[model samples]
Target chain A: MGPVPDRPATSSRTPADRPATASGPGRVLIAVYAIFAVAATSRAAVQIATRFDEAPVPYALSAFAAVVYVLATFALARTGPTWWRVALVSCSVEMTGVLVVGTLSVFDRAAFPDATVWSNFGMGYLFIPLVLPVIGLLWLRRTRPA
Target chain B: MITGYAIAVAACAAGVAIWAFVLVVLHREPEKPLLMGVGALEALLAVQVVISVVMLIGGGEPGSMLTFLAYLVGSLLVLPLGTVWALAERTRSSTAILGILCLTVPVLLLRMVEVWGGASA
Candidate 1:
């Protein structure tokens, strides 16, 4: 196979000329977000289908996280001012969700009968979920994909 | 997962992962060997999935068949995902998308083994 790259090499460009959010390091972010999108979606599907009545809060939250992950994945991968802002908003929501849900899950154990991706600030996920959006927002800011 | 086969897959993936990582660390473009190595590793993963499918067809049972199947299917999907990564600019970050993906297979296999051993959900 030819080693052709879709975009030209970026070694000569300054940070200010960074292309769309889906290129360069943004590709890595998309890779990770895609993983979480699948992970959270599948987890929620199983929980909701089998045991929704048992613990609706965490299950619903899992689904919500899944949607956010999906949205963020697309928003980051797609190019446009609109998608860039969508990614920004989605990452903000993700950061807030993880922190708020994480704190609540800690302070009130009874509230969350089971764990969502954001539970305990994603402690169960080795806290990658906690860190992903933080990096995502920063990446978005730094790139400011136009 | 047979202990030997698991070890083989993990070892192969480790070599590939390290190579990919070294490329990232050194800020090098993906050379022929590394991309070919990914192709080889993917073939190994495919064999692994086939083995699992055979075991299931032969009456082996995982605790949660759905989850087990999902992991199996998901494991095979890394190649397609890599296609996207490959088509992008061969930047260090772009290359790392595949490198990070190489590490997931062993984890997926480990999780599959747990499910096979009757861990649920």
Candidate 2:
């Protein structure tokens, strides 16, 4: 086996040299994003596969949200101007999706007999869906390349 | 889904999460004690997977076998993966990541219970 790598010094390199979008506190953010990516994707897959006919609107919305999450997670982890644009667009769309779905679910309960991840502003998810994009946008702005 | 074991896992996960939170607040890197706590929780989760699989083999019918098994595997993966991710960047945020990882275990457990035919609101 390879030698055990040094843990602290190598890992704690100064943030100036690291890509701002995925360094330090941003790592934690990315971790959270990754969790959401996996969760949403699996949920949408299961919902679509098992009961799409029962609630096609909400299940399709779930699939769309899952795709957005996967894209956002990918863009956030990568480095490049193109990836930055991708992240920005995905986060913006996510914000809009959550807000629109949230409101529609509330006023049009008949439309969503089953809950998508964004229903009621992601109430089932402790509102992380509603909040994550705000944080993502702020992180992107703060980490914009000079 | 054994309610007692699920509660135990939840309690231990909560403890580990609190420990991770304390490390983050102090601006300390993840250390041995935290890793040990995670290990303990991982052990519990391993047992949970074994018991669940055995029960399934013994004809316990969950609402959806695939979802239940997915959650079981996910619970096993979270800690070790999070620890690797945290160690890859030993910073305050890394500890926060561990906290997030620990917090997710209880959520997974709850989902497992729900998929195993428990009540869901």
Candidate 3:
């Protein structure tokens, strides 16, 4: 109806004065997203390189999670609506991935011989992986276009 | 690795709890003294890295030397990187970041310890 809510705040600013990083809660979210990107990427790299045969499914999932985190970090950090949509897409995917992977890993341990980023509901990573998307969604809602 | 990691973990637990109280509960940024404290922690982590490396060279290598090396290097870098990142914000958020990093370093250190201690002890 009204151009969809949560329009990006950075969209209106001139290129010269436009802020580099997201502001306030957005900044915090970006930081978390960035951390996850680094952590997941590195973990996947190690897992796949050292022991690909250990658990193909979980390792692949780890790589997937890493991509989502990377995209979310970039989207959250970039300015304008394009990046906002990117962030939303990646965050949604991340949430779904964690939920599905978390549940499956628990119900079917055989499927996950080794732990991925989303394994055990990300318990190894302090459950931050589970909580992060929920927070990201909330932050997105709050910053939605008026 | 065990001794250094134990000290690191203890320090991080204390540091993060304090910062969490200050930032989340009190809603304030860390003062100069807190920053200095982090610096102290960083020094300890540097020392840990040295100890771990020595142990590794002395024939106590982990199962995966590469991963262990990466974690060792990462743990050492956390405090300095965190301090820089937090200083830019200079707000309650920054302090929270510091706390989180502090907490993370110890966890990383613990993992490093376990990896080394588990294998070639």
Candidate 4:
């Protein structure tokens, strides 16, 4: 291979110049992820601080969901294969968390006396929590490199 | 919580959401008028935040003061942050972010009102 052309500095690049996950509808996904991150983190923080003893499982799950959202949002906003893998893992975990928590919360109400971001498959969130990960996974697949 | 004011804020937010989606349907960017609408809604939200602060200072309480305060900050910041994110992309979907934020503000507002009611109870 001939000498590679001089690489432009990374700092000046726009989202348009980055990965597919940073453009168009992907940005909208990022916005949604951000909202959930903020909502879940704050909710979990308050729950844990105020009443951890009352319901540790659900509150802890909220924090975990918030972290996954945060990770996915950050990964999608950045460029590179590493971040892509991170985003994929985060979304997978999010999907599993919602399904498992949702199922358990429904059949075993005593276990989740309190609600979580994933309780009832995110029914409280209009099922966005349940729906978002599936969409995210699809988007990731659509944008994947050959 | 200011009962009538809360209603007004929620209505205004819903109105903004509808307006943003209309822009999307028309294939238009967020125009100045739409931004102004958000600005007006932001001012109304500010009033709600002010009332909350006053309540706390005047020995009023919320069921969970921490939760209430966090929602107050989150509700106020959504519009500004969403606006920035929209402008960053400058695409049709960018405009959609405004709609999402507009929708979120009302939910946040409703939660705040509920928290305030809890405190008063």
Candidate 5:
């Protein structure tokens, strides 16, 4: 309700004085990540539970993508050098997963009769899966401990 | 899954989504009106959940009942959770988070409708 406080000054004063990963802009990022985490996890759960036999590869990949998103969300929310490193690794892996799975799903339509979160670079999820890790890596870089 | 109700919910969500975006553009945090709007959307979602449950119990079997129920619960959750996250810090980013939350409602609703219709057919 009060006037927006000046944030850049405080953030700049102590480069080592990094805010918690869940604070400020990071909060928004984490929220988005949390959404994806829930979405992918649930979708994977349902697919694997009910119809894993139909498309095991895509369903398993969905589960894998869910796990990665969950880890990324957790690592991004935590504070510390270790957690930061974990986030970096998780996002990198996520980037690689999306690209690889997305490409495969695109060129070999027969291979993906069922869509995973990374199918076609997450076209089903509005391409957020494709873009989220990029933003996450940038955020992690900006917030890296100095 | 009801068409009229879905449309109503989407309209409410769109109104709040725009309000949240305007707050972000103006570099303002979410204030009372915005929070109230979220609260209103939450109320609508709650109503939706109840209606959905009633329909399910009344032999309105969706194609995948578990999936439909999960989405119903998820739709009810997003606004409250997003509001808590947004209120944790009063900043433009917080407002932007609210906007994103608002936008998610319609997507969830649309998916719910798809699942419902898919089951009925």
Candidate 6:
């Protein structure tokens, strides 16, 4: 219920001096990434647990995407320079994952009978899965160390 | 069912309106009143969860009980989490977070309804 401790109320301290707690657009972005991590992991778990026979490739992709999302969320929420580097790497990987998975899903429909988070550029996810990484990377860039 | 659908639609519309207001008009942090409105939506979602459970108990179970339940739970979760996350920021970005979660809820709810209705029918 309290305001994020990381940010002083209208203070002029630098990002390093600020607490590591997420705030502002960072809060929103973390929320989104956290949601996706939960969603993708849960979906993959259910699919794999209940009917792994349905589509193994897509299911595995879902699990992989879920892990990336988890890492990216953590990295973005962290305040230090090391975490910033981690976020940059994860976002780049995420962007590549979406592109590769989207193109492969299109060219090789036989491999993806069921959809994964990255399938068809996250078409089932309104392409947000694809777009999120670009936005995340941009946000990181905007907040990067000078 | 009709009322639920209507409410979901209304929630989505309200979310868009709030986003517009936040991004354009207010240019301020997320106000308490608007947060209360989102709280109201969360309460409605809680009602929807209860209704869904009741419907399942009343001989309206979906084919994939597990998946259906997961979605039902997921739809219920987004609001409170979004609310808290936005509360932390209390800024336009927070409002944007609320908007995103609001938009996501209806989509998930509709999907749950579809899965439920499809299996039952």
Cα lDDT for residue B85, candidate 1: 66
Q: Tell me candidate 6's TM-score on chain B.
A: 0.79
After the best TM-score superposition of candidate 1, give how far the Cα of residue A59 lies from its true spot, in angstroms. Answer: 0.8
Using lDDT as the measure, name the better of candidate 1 and candidate 2. Answer: 2
**Model 5 misses residue A52 by how many Å?**
0.7
Per-model TM-score versus the true fold: 0.90, 0.91, 0.85, 0.90, 0.94, 0.86
Candidate 1 lDDT, tens digit per residue, A25-98? 77888988998998899889988887799988789999999999999999998877799899999999999999
Best by TM-score: 5
TM-score of 2: 0.91
Question: Quick one: ranking by lDDT, best first?
Answer: 5, 2, 1, 4, 6, 3
Tens-place lDDT digits, model 5, residues B1-121? 5868987998899999999898887778778888888899999999888888888888886788889988998998888887887776667887889999999999999888888887511
Q: Tell me the tens digit of each residue's lDDT in model 4 across A1-146.
A: 12211222332233444436776678888999999998888888888887899888788888999899999999988766687789999999999999999999999999998888999999989999999999999878866644
Global lDDT scores for all candidate models: 0.83, 0.84, 0.73, 0.83, 0.86, 0.75
Model 1 residue B89 CA deviation in Å: 2.1
Kindly give the stretch of ten consecutive residues in candidate 5 chain B with the minimal lDDT sum: B112-121
Clashing pairs in 4: none
Clashing residue pairs in candidate 6 are none
Q: Is candidate 2 or candidate 4 better by lDDT?
A: 2
Q: Which pairs of residues collide in candidate 3?
A: A5-A145, A6-A144, A6-A145, A7-A145
Count backbone clashes in candidate 6: 0
The DockQ assigned to candidate 1 is 0.38
Which structure among the candidates has the greatest DockQ? 5
Off by over 4 Å in 5: A1-19, B119-121
Residue A90 error for model 5, in Å? Answer: 0.7
